[model samples]
Target: MSPKIHFISGLPRSGSTLLAALLRQNPRFHASMSTPVGSLVNRMLEAMSEDNEYSVFISPEQKRAMISGIFSAYYQPQAEKAVIFDTNRLWCSKLSLIKELFPGAKVICCVRNVAWIMDSIERLVRKNSFDVSQLFNNPTERATVYTRTEALSQGGRLVGFAYNALKEAFYSEESERLLLVDYDLLAQNPEKVLSLFYQFLEEEPFQHDFENVQYDEPEFDNRLNLKGLHKVRSKVELQQRQTILPPDLFIQFNGLSFWTTPSNSLANLIVAQPK
Candidate 1:
């Protein structure tokens, strides 16, 4: 049997990277930011679904297993005993498929206010003074706050697509399989929040050194003009950050999160696996 694995998917810049970095501190865990599992599945479906001669030769079952084979191949390098956490935003959209592929797998979604999610991306873009971000794939297009806001929320970007997909998973029959970890809660009280997460995953406690965590992907960051995009803090404590976005602009996406609403029964749930 393949080794156990779960998924880390949620709003970009909402701490998924930090969560993965922390999880990897456990020698028994294998975790990383935005792994290719989701993308591989998407690419395979795109190629095989075409109405061509090759399409007739492949069965649906074969395709499914092949998609899973990608995961098996990617994680084959890890110790056979390690539990994996594959991170990707597209995982949010494939709820039914993921449930079938990894029956007991839980998706940990790091969330902040929608407005702030947008704000975080914008802040990074602004930080790269000379290098325009390839975030939207238009490096030369210097986007303003208003224009960027529209573009992010309207298209294939993280905040828009994944946010919608999360809502779908939250309301599905598999809603119990999703955990929404708020950025503020994770920032201010990681121990409390992560305890719930570990409990949900049914993992034994690891003596995580919150005081010293290090992660960076400078090459990947440079490709996108985000030099320090993947940098993680040495300490897990919440540091004060005043949003560069205006109050009016930031408020636009404040209430977009369902977790903060009264009807959100799954808010901050530690585990979504069935008992």
Candidate 2:
């Protein structure tokens, strides 16, 4: 039988990596950083769309089965696990498809302040001064913090694309399938967060050691010249830091965390209480 499938999504530079690291601690569960399965699913759909001249020969049932097989094929080795959490930022934009593929599947979105997301990416760029990130196309886009931040926040870029997709999911009809977990809350009080997380997934809780948690993708990071991009610290504790971004630029994302407000959508959200 196929493993119980779920998804991990939300903004970049958030705690998706940490969340996956924690989830994988459960022997019955399989989780990891972003996977190519999402990309493969999209490509498969495109191949069967009107853009392909022969798509008329493919029926809806065939398309659905083929798309569903994408996940099964990629994770055939992990079928023994009771659950599998596929990580991909684009999953946030594809909630409808997820509903059709795995009706019971839920998506956990790891989110943080939009300003902090930008700050985190900026810090990574500065840390790897010797290499140009594939996130940008040319030297001009990586010239300065202003250019870099602006380029990344463009609709099609990494941060912006994820952010927009997350917003779309937040308000979508399938919003109930989403659970937004704030990074700060997850780091500062992991056990509490995990308890609630398990409750949401209706799974038996496993003892996750916050201190010894470990996960990283050095090869993937190296390929993008963004080393440590998905690296999770051994300890799961919130690190307090001042903004590395300019005041004006930082303030631009002031109210972008729409999940903080309960009045907006039906999605469940676990956020830190305001001071």
Candidate 3:
């Protein structure tokens, strides 16, 4: 059987990494930490002084070559079930090229509330992964630019962009196979959410332990402190006020809030009580 490919798309710090880590524990699945394709593409763009266009001009032959190389390099041949999960934040931005590479693959969109996502990203900036100097360069230009900050602003604007892109894909002749999973639900009811994921991939659920899933802790030592990062993010949020996202994206991704509600009977079921 041809290897199954699952594309995990979402804002950074929105739990895609956690999901990938959990999925990798299953014997049948082969998942990698965020691959170099995106970073490579970004470097290429910076080198060319152009926006993302590496995949745009690539011929069909080249596209196949690149995808095959990525697969062979990242995926282990011994994986029993042969499902390859590509966890990349920029995959959604390059949906067209990704489709060309893996036509039969299933797209799994992970979403979260914009505010919380921004808060998380702000924390990330404190860790020094992004340059805070970009925030002050040009607010309008920066808003349109794809900084790690813009990716984290999980509110309406980012969701709207993703929604419109997915809508176009689904409506297009090429997209009958995309699935969306809420990040909050996955965190709250991992077993149930993962069961659905397994069913979607047509794989038998493995009897694996979820409690031991290793997740990296958020670190802070970058340019901005928590207070400074939030202040800058607040400024960006103000500039983004007119670009609100659709309500459905929020509804679909806000499952975490619902699961946390007192009356939801399952509230305590999957939640880990603090010691």
Candidate 4:
């Protein structure tokens, strides 16, 4: 049987990494870290330093080979029954490329509230954990505070882009092969989420002890923070009642302004019932 490929995508800190790590625990799954081709292309562009002239120099064939190379290097020869899972946010930005690379791969798009995701990203940057500013900045280190701020503030838009990309991909592809998992729902009912996930993969769910599942705490790179790049939480609201809702309905559905937006104040007016 051909190796099964699974692509997991979502905005940063939306629990994509945690889900990837958990999926890796399954004996038949080989989930790897984020390896976005767009990110690689972005890096290459930065190296070239040709403003507005830099294009995707790598041909489609080369891009496909690069993705195949990642799988062969990391997952090949592991086990025949093992499925390869690439948990990369960069893939979210290049859904078309990903679809071209793994023609029949299962796409898993994770969803989370835009406000919470933005807040989480803020915490990550403040702690100097993972710097995604490189994607939007040249020399990465020279990334302005506004660039960093915009990345977090535009969580809804990012999620929307990913969702729309996946939607378009699925529109022209098989419907049974794509899955969307909500982070909040999974957090509330992991067992239910896992059951649905297993159903999607057509795999038998097994009982495993998760009491000792060791999750590594994210470490902050103090060296990066030493540059006096202090983290500042913005008070900007994400919801402004735009003309069109972002393509990613999940992002907008799950409360548009949880942490930073003033429009979310209306959400607080709703009374919560006792569970």
Candidate 5:
């Protein structure tokens, strides 16, 4: 049976992990910590592109089945009734294919202030002085946080690629298929946020124990020298203080949340029309 599948994507350090952790509370749902399915899809498409040797033999419909088969193959272990959420930043950029392949599938995009996103990553690097994160391929010598942040937010880096991809999808006609999940709302008012998200997915709500949700992949993070990167507290709570990033760095992306600003077409478009 082809299982119901959705997607999780958006900016880095924007609470995707936390959302996944909370969603796993429902036994019928299957969520992974940044799986490589999206990358594989892209590579398969590359292999069948016009420049590839197999381009002549591969039909469009065959390509579709091949890509879809990847999902079916990898997630075959889950119960046929389970709902799957494939996490990947590149999903946003691939919305056209996703819409074509999955029909009514929706994407849950996690979002937060860009500055704070950078700050969170920088804090990770600073807190673990001797190690650099896989965010930059785990370099041996540590770079200045400012330098690192700049490099990461520039083109082709984690933040930049996801940021650009999200903007493209947010502006696309398929925008209705995307639900934006704010980091603050998630941490501060989880039940409400989750309720809204569940409603979007049209699934009956399941009782979630806010006090005891468990999720962690420290072993995975340690490989990146970003130990505890996906660690979530037993309890979800919002921070009561300002970020530790320097004001200049923090302000760089503070007021740039286009999705929340009322006048911004992108912000208002999501709600003005029903999906």
Candidate 6:
């Protein structure tokens, strides 16, 4: 039998990579940074869509099987593991399709304040110093923190798409299968968060070493010219620091943490206490 599949998704710079690193410590689990399976599944859907010349020859059941086969084959090497946690930001947006394919699957969404998320990205851009990021189209878009954040927050862009997709799943009819894990909460108290996380999945708990966690994708980061983009510290704890974003720019995203509004969230959430 194939291992149970769950997903790690949500905002960038939000701890999904760290969560994956911690989860993989479990002998029965397999987890990692973003995998190619998500993109492959999307491409498969496009190929089977009406735009394809042979779409008339494909049936819905066949298409489903083909898509399902992607996961089974991609994780075949880890077939011995009892569970697999696939990481991808786009998964939140496709909750309906996810449910259709894996009815028991759950999505663990790692979230943080939008302002901090922008700050984290800006920090990365400044840290690389010499390399230009492919995240933006051209030099004009990367000219300033304001321009960069603006470009990133466009409805179709990176941060914006994930935020919107999270909101979509947060309030969708399938929200029950989702769990929103705050980045601060995970960083500060991973054990507590993992307890809630396991309860949400109804899976038995496995002890995770919060102090010695490890995960990094240097090649992937270098490819984007965003070094340390997916690096996790050897220890799990929040670092105290002031924002590099200009005051005005940081404040622009003040009220975007919609998950804080209890009335708007239907999914289970594990968040930090208000300061």
> Each model's TM-score?
0.92, 0.98, 0.57, 0.58, 0.92, 0.98
**Total clashes, candidate 3?**
3
Angstrom error of the Cα, residue 92, model 4: value is 3.3
Could you tally the backbone clashes for each prediction?
0, 0, 3, 1, 0, 0
Q: What lDDT tens digits, residue by residue, belong to model 5 across residues 1-275?
A: 56799999988998898888888889889886799899899999998899887699998899999999898888888746569998999999998999889998888889887888887887787777787566774442245666777778776888889999888888888888889888877888888888888888999998888788688998888988887788888888988766877788787867656666543323222221111
Local distance difference test, per candidate? 0.79, 0.92, 0.53, 0.51, 0.81, 0.92
- Clash pairs detected, candidate 2: none
Cα lDDT tens digits, model 3, 1-275, are 75677777654444566677777677778765456766565454454443645556766576457656655655556345578787765665665666766767776766555545544544444454345433333544345224434443333344445544544543444444555555656666677877877777778888655557654322322232222332211110111232232355334444432222344121112222222
List runs of model 2 lying over 4 Å from the truth: none
Model 3 TM-score on a 0 to 1 scale: 0.57
Ranking by lDDT: 2, 6, 5, 1, 3, 4
lDDT tens digits by residue: candidate 2, 12-93: 9889999999999999999999999999998999999999999999999999999988888899999999999999999999
The ten-residue window of minimal lDDT in model 2 covers 254-263
* Tens-digit lDDT track of model 6 for 1-275: 78999999998889999999999899999999999999999999999999999999999999999999999999999999999999999999999999999999999999999999999999999998899898999888899998999999998898999999998999899998889999998998889999989889989998899899889999998999999998889999999999998999888986688888767557988976455
Instruction: State the displacement of the C-alpha of residue 237, model 2, in Å, after optimal TM-score superposition.
Output: 0.4
Backbone clashes in model 4, listed as residue pairs: 237-261
Off by over 4 Å in 5: 137-142, 263-275
State how far residue 207 of model 4 sits from its true place (Å).
2.3
Q: How far does residue 261 in candidate 4 sit from its true spot (Å)?
A: 20
Q: Where in model 1 is the C-alpha error above 4 Å?
A: 139-141, 264-275
Residue ranges of candidate 4 with Cα displaced over 4 Å: 36-67, 77-81, 125-148, 154-176, 217-275
Candidate 4, residue 59: Cα displacement in angstroms equals 9.4
Superposition TM-score, candidate 6 onto the true structure:
0.98
Give residue 201's lDDT in candidate 2 (0 to 100).
97
